[model samples]
Target chain A: MPIDEALLERMLLRESVSEFLYREADLLDERRYTEWLDMLAEDYQYSVPLRMNVAFGETDAREETRAGREICWFDEGKETMSLRVDQLNTGLHWAEEPVSRISHLVTNIRLDAVELPEVAVSCRFLVYRNRVADETDFLVGRRKDRLRQVGDSWHVVRRELLLDQSVLLAKNLSIFV
Target chain B: MTTVEEPTRTGAPQVRNLVDVKNGEISREIFIDEQIFKNELENLFPRAWLFVGHATQVPEPGDFFSSWMGADPVLLTRDDKGELNVLLNSCRHRGMRVCRYDEGNTLQFTCPYHAWSYSIDGSLVDTPGALHGVPQQKAAYGTNLEREKWGLVRAAQVHNYKGLVFANWDPEAPSFDEYVGDFHWWLDNLADAFDGTEGGTEAFRGVHKWRIRSNWKFVSENFLGDTYHGASTHASVEAVGIGPGGKGKRRHGERQNEGGFSKGRMKTSFRRGHGASDNLAYEIPYPEFEEAELDEYFVAAWEKRKEKLQAEGRLLGGRGPATLFPNMSFAAGFPRTILVAHPISPTETEVWRWYLVDKSAPEKVRDWLRHYYMRYAGPAGMTEQDDMENWDYATEASRGVVARRYPYNYQQGLGQETASDLDGSVHSHHAIAGEVNARAFYRRWAEFVDNLSWPELTELARVDDRATERDAVVTDVAEGVKVLDAVDVVDGPPAQ
Candidate 1:
């Protein structure tokens, strides 16, 4: 078969990107918060919009609360995200004192756009948290991210998530999802 | 004590027996019993003025915000004449919910099931939410269906206290003013701007809502002057320091006075069942922000507020992490917000939280407050996440067969109730660490659940026994000398 150079380069890019995501999931699940934080760029932006049961045609625009102008489950940058990590490290944080067993299942990754040094990705995340004597919660959501290539690694520049819930079924979003 | 069968005997004797407020021992049954839950639904919720939504949520005509009053789904709608109405969301024809969207603007709600439309349009009906159109009225009903009688069941009374909206199902329910009493001061702080401007605040766009497997009362009691839990429950967040002052500062970012954070902190408990954790005398200025712009904004606002409130001879200290009886809880400072615990079952509650901000605040100031609110108050909030863990586990732990035999102790500040300056209210001398508010709250809950008449409830609150005892008792905190000689406050043999 005749080898196509362009197709080969694309396949290699896919492999590296998939590896980067799987590694990120491992870092989070392993409770290596600092390492996970490193994977995020200094200008990293994060948000989880509050889902609403809007009318049919309104879904495309009004289903989720606006990010900057309106309230969201979370709306912050690296500074606040760092504080969350700091809270977890304290061991005094009662919500996660016992250190819940958490598993972040990141899959169905697709590259929506690929620029020179950046790529836009869309994926699904299912975070399973089991803590202290049978307490369990499953957080399922869609996560969209913009990844920036830095040397041999990728840094998450922005992440927007939409949890598949109108009223959050989980008691608390204590663990990172 | 015999537990009566609740089906036919859902009255005062059973409820009164469960709540021993004088002795400060409340049976666990009140928290978990199915009969008590049903009693609350039938007797308490229907008669009490439960919080609906803010006026700003539906400012424009035809705007409707779907909310809940106890078990009933309500639509808070603004009419063409700029009037607000709280209407039952269920359609009269087939009991189908006419409005399913969380919020939207519409001239009328048309039932998906039967096409029976209720016009919110002023031109169609004299009142908004009146039955304006019925599908094939001439053919299907043949003039038998009474459109006048079938208008959505409107709330008997709906009051817009500044921007906070409240609704009552029973006509006999006390007016919102009488029900709130001196507690209105706390609400004034919540509804007004940081600078004491009347009704100068509005809620942010989204409301944080979620379900928790804990009795709704647990949520209520926590906010009802349960300041004792702060040290232990929120220890981690305090250490993390997400407050405006940044790292190593308290969550509230107190400016640091001589006596510390709890310097003059006291529990203000009203016989009307409302409670506030912070006393009016203890004036703690808003936090000193690490960010210069935030500091400048708050300091200027605080100064202006002090000048305004002081000129009016009002106390500059209505900053409350307070609870308006039945379900509404709020705080007016730092992260100003409202929380209402909607009871789902004996062991489940759906909590809705609305954040308030100054309407005239700069974009930067608003954004700062918004971010601060999200990280501090809700289920995803660092400070509040710990609360959920504790509440869920506590409810679970208390549900065991063996656990139900005991009663939860409410004897923290038994007889330390000092006479208050306000009407129908008392302040616990122990202040920072007291269950006085919780005791009064449960006592009022029992009275309401027992189906006490409006006049009877008013009379009982009008003559608070705690205030009358203020004369005789000389409180020795170390000794636990109670107000009543008959009711010993501690576990030891007696207060010798």
Candidate 2:
């Protein structure tokens, strides 16, 4: 009976995490940037490292540019993210001024670790952005996250994304993934 | 009478007709037409001195960084003798790309297809990228294949100007020094550290490269004295300030009391198409940071640089958002960096950005700059993201037949140029708004695309009648903008 209860606990926790990620995606897609910002803890760190093309065996060492050390696409804490949100609201950030229609689909969710109060997660993201007349981009990537429990909800403390691209295909990364 | 020419169509008149400097009009065909794109790749790129990867990228012997010179892929390598080399990446055999990896360390690049090899190792070949081995040499060709002359094609000339490597495919074009001229002042600010050490900077390990659907010229024009766009195009970023001074400050983080952004910033337009947004006279100090350590570090650097440069009798300005004609562009202040807009087609370009930092910077300063540079430029930067939107949409909308008929205007500050102390260059004292740089750039572009002989190009630029004519009528600046007539705005910096 105890073993069965433990398995059920794991299942419930996975569902909760999945629901939190899905709700986060909904907020982003709905352009409720302020609400989405609330989902992040004050100490939240987000990074999107540049992917490199290296020889087969050298990938483990050189494939992804380091987050805090090397030059990456987006590397900063909540303050920078808040500024990015401010830029979006200005109605003059031409890249997102007209408001890009974005669909952030988070799937393949896996609970990597759970030390209580904090949980590590892994997920795949397929973000589709279309704007203006015909500009379209599909950014597919693997993402890792560290979430902290807050009573009934969860707050993202850290996120690291590894886009499966050597050279970014999109013209601008104006939307949050 | 500018009209679009379909690719392969003949007798379309000279490219000079498409670029009318007198009227300050440039036809849209050059940016959207396929044939003109081919002409640019074939004629202009080969002759122009282009910025390749830096020497630090390949510091160790056998290290390589795959780069692009215009449209051609090149392997920037360091040979066994510890010399840098720029070789065509295509294999000598089946023309396969010899190195597909973005960067690595390898003495020889063996063709993945046929296994034919070329070596930069001293024991294997006389020169770097020389053909070292051929699979089945005697079995397949029976001593008929001459490996001596079958090596990967090498760049005709490669010059490492203070660690910023540049290459040209035309051996007769001009020496890098001759080509750069007094524009080296801008290059000096870019390549050197903030403390005025000669070539004391190196590129960061990661490069931010992304594809944008825009003609390459759009990228070049924006940086080449297009200060006019900053207000309207970057209003959002300005409102949200991502500068060293942190939020609510100007994005450039310029000192608080500097008369509103454009006060003394003048446009320096060179006869050879190289251009800078700020002049040597405009010497605005570097930005102020909110963090005290950052302020201390930069202020100390400023003092050191002032002492060193003044002692050397060099003007302490000309830190530019400048373009080194034909495509390389860079900015030296507020997050120093290099950008190369490689032509993919008429309407698509691959933009590569490399950030620079002083080699001697402390860990804190280095980290702060690295973070600042990431947020300030490139496709992902708040300031640059909007630029891509404009560039892409401009290229897309201009493809309509009705839109191509209306030529873009480059008439701002038309025919208003003052002489400079630097040779073969002029200054547009509009301070804030001037298209003189773009006009000069387009004129030089036409000459290169038309494949004018090196002598003709040199002679045309040596004593440019247009600049001279402006000099003659310098006082006739129509808009009543202060035009410093017959003034050497750059004063006189000791030539290197």
Candidate 3:
């Protein structure tokens, strides 16, 4: 069967996709967590797997360093994430008691495949976070996300974050990357 | 300028001056003095059994993990024949670190500075173009430049308890068994075989590491006995209805009974300053936010492991924080954990934390435990943030000119130590507030700083558990206050 390039391009290559991702990053940077939660689907999953310093030549590195098998920074569902946000609002999340100032620089947005209402998107992100004076942390990573269309907007259904450092040097991962 | 005498200076504090036993005072110099920190590296670290990494981290041949023993970088490797080796990570040539990565599997590690390569067993296998690069390598280096003589420097002793790997630099230091002493019974509660598996506990995949601007001893002594700070330090967590406070709210509030009469709670000081704050028959209450089935799975797993625990007499009705002498600490709560601190300087430390779970438990149970560990104790954990804030401030406060003159008080429950049913342990009946364990720790520190012989240290560690013979003093500053004061206590009442 011949592929429908026109429909695929219309769903994935639309400018609205990149704009939506930019808006999401802005929401996080501004600490507008409650508003950002609206961008996630009802059954969304967010996870960041532990990166391993596997030897350069090892072929099974990907398999050995994936989610579920090894320890992770986060492997949260929507409900768990919601609880975290609610806790943050209580002003008792000591890691965030003073609130960290973050700049989420999201770039290199690319839409790979489109399947009806679902689209696969990937982007690079660099988050600079500062807590009070003399404390700062920078995180660089790539996120693979699956976004589902809800009315005129796209809701994040799944996200897998791959970080650059194996052993995090930062004091804490309290702020979102 | 007016003449002013320095409070005291002889590089390190004299053993007698460091701690005032009867007064229960600890000198601020030990925590902030630069020369004392350097002395510790030479006098204490080498003589202590420092934890490196777990055996499972490098289960197969050629696997390795880069770790540190105080300021010295070391590598933990499993050889082709399956023997574990702890080798200095620095190359014998030019002092370059041979392995740069945190962990990996490699048959040979090649130094980036000079292409000096070492085999998994830490033998200097090859040097790139050694014959051509410098004929002086044979002349200046002498005729006896043999590869066999240039092998990596290994720890004088390497041993594993359960799966936790430990190494020592001094050949004359006591064996791991002698060093651990009576804590064997308490340690088994956190380790030992699982219900359905042949192997005992195993650390989960990755280690959680972070830097803290505080002295390592602050962390070690806190976990060793400072249970009094829990309710107040972590009050925010309780208010937010999360973490240990939320799940075990009943136990958290009711555990403290004013004059320190908390049932099933006691402090056990083992030989060589190792000590633990224990609670008998501790319960793990599931939080309402978690899945309901998590409790059921945990109960099922606990039932299977309880039989072995009871048979060996290692099962405790309650569990709490414990310290293994110098720097290692154990949290024998749900999702068993070990926290190790590596001193970077007098006021800086790097902390490494590992979560140990029974391999035989259901996969779901293990997952839940892993989640609990990350959520409660690590750098990003809710509970850990509260403790770190206090420790950081404590370290900064010790640097004051006048403040350093006055010693920090460790007098609570000082004269209340009681004889224990467990042999070779100094037991304190008070659970929530007590300085008995900290006093024991500082006493050992003074012996080490004084450069006492192993025999002398062993003899010093031996004393009547029923009284304060080891804690007696003959100093002018000794203020003999026996009973614990109300202002010194903060923990709430015990659970129903």
Candidate 4:
């Protein structure tokens, strides 16, 4: 059976979102904060939940309980993002001071329909960061992004990055993926 | 007539005199030397009350999370009976990690290597291949090993105060309250400020783990004493108007132009290594929001705390910034807590920060606090990023042959430290510069590194003459506060 027009449109949206993500990665890797900032909505929300070892066979990968859900790290809004970008631009931001060359490879894009209009998009991503003075540290994770079509462009309303490793090898998370 | 015993161990030096504290700058050997590292793993780590995860991490009966103490993996789980248990993550048969994942809810943990299963309580439930292969079946493997004795080793002591869990390997260490000492007051203030009506606040998942190349002490000292670097190192933040503006512009309520503000801030250090710089009254300056907007929250919390203090017949007008000895530290009123844990070598440390908000607070308050915290303190936080860069460089620089030759100079305010106006608090005139807080930390470090028994260490600390000047200031301040209180009643509560 041929794909429906609505399905085709959805696929196009997915592709566009994926392309935008790659472009965003490129902007960050190339140190283009201005361009990167332009891509974000003024009220965009970004968060990376701390991954923990949950019991086997449980479907709820992210635990948000009062006691067990500790925030390992996160960025809440655009103002924070501006501060971070500004720090990076200056000779400050010691974590990334020397600046690590980063390559974010995003692949295996899969779209699952949870409900109409709000699709769950999952992609495999491997981020390699090479600090100028230290050994390279790599992070591989699955990005579960909630993309919404706001007019012509797709904006990331919510994103959950689930990293495979619980004990991270990187010294500090000064970079964003 | 006294006889001195000669040191038998080749690398082990004789116990030096307490007066030798002057020479006790942390040696790079503590970070790099394999022997010293081993000694620390055996001696320091196993003895101290190492922080584990918060109780919230394992909320439900079956909920569990895995963590590490040095190299030893441990599983923190809530059992079938809902009791929190910290168990070694090793299997009985071949010593494999029972649960490999970081956290989850489960009835039991099964070893993948040999299929040995264990209940959440660390009781061996089944040995898959034992009954069929062994002639004695249950006798050979199951019934022979006492399930209680053979199960995972529980931490020596696991306790929590206000949802924060800590475990110590030493059974004889001071009680949690005693170990916390004056730091307990800071924790109380923090817990009291929490807006959560349902007992305590929750940590959002997503730990940003990264390594820095410097000694663990460097990280601790940096956080403990280096507020001086904030304006200079984070100039970018100022340029972007995220943090304090450069030169004379005060970003927060902090009076950047006044020398006394910095000095008054530095003088606030608690006994037992807990200390905070700037904001002597444990209040984090709020430059982001207008005073009118913040007054409701701050005044309400402060008024409640003041009433509690008054009922207890204590002074509430001033209590300095907060710090917990060894690892944990916080700016309480700001509602941010940093828990720093040493994971591997002394040079390697893991920093975890929680943006604490009152549980009963409005969603907007929580959201705003989360936003502010992330902007300044989180892994991607501008200020934190600036600090991390310096940390990474400090670590890298320490590894250099020439740089290692010189001892890190923490003598910024050395002899000039003033005592707190209250008991068990120390102060410095300049909060921005490194001062008594750093000295206090190093003094405690010398005590720990010298391997003094707990009682002996406490005794020696009490008699140590270096703190006399600070102590005098504390006594005078306490007395002065008392006089101020008496006059406050007569003055009819001054102008608001």
**Highest lDDT: which candidate?**
2
Tens digits of per-residue lDDT for model 1 on A8-44? Answer: 8877887788899999989999999998999999999
Interface CA RMSD of each prediction in angstroms: 0.7, 0.7, 2.5, 3.9
Query: lDDT tens string, model 1, B256-346?
Result: 5522233445568999888887767667678877789888888888899999988888886766688899999988887788999999999
Model 1 TM-score on a 0 to 1 scale: 0.95
Write down the worst ten-residue block by lDDT for model 1 chain B: B487-496
lDDT, candidate 3, at B250:
30
Q: Could you tell me how far off, in angstroms, the CA of residue A19 lies in candidate 2 after the best superposition? A: 0.5
Q: Which stretches of candidate 4 lie over 4 Å from their true place?
A: A1-25, A61-75, A108-123, A144-160, B1-26, B78-83, B106-137, B141-144, B194-208, B241-263, B268-271, B278-295, B315-323, B421-425, B469-496
Fnat values, one per model, are 0.84, 0.90, 0.38, 0.68
lDDT of 2 at A87: 93
lDDT tens digits by residue: candidate 2, B18-82: 99988889999889988788888888998899999889899998999989998899999999898
* Ranked by lDDT, top first: 2, 1, 3, 4
lDDT of 3 by residue, A1-177 (tens): 888998776755557788898899899988899999999999998878766655567626532344664567776677656656765776766667688888998888888777858989889988898876767788898989999988889999999988776666676677766
Two-way DockQ contest, 1 vs 3, winner: 1
Between candidates 1 and 2, name the one with more favorable DockQ: 2
Model 2: share of real contacts kept: 0.90
**Candidate 2: stretches off by over 4 Å:** A1-3, B4-13, B259-261, B470-496
Best by TM-score: 2
Clashes of each: 0, 0, 15, 50
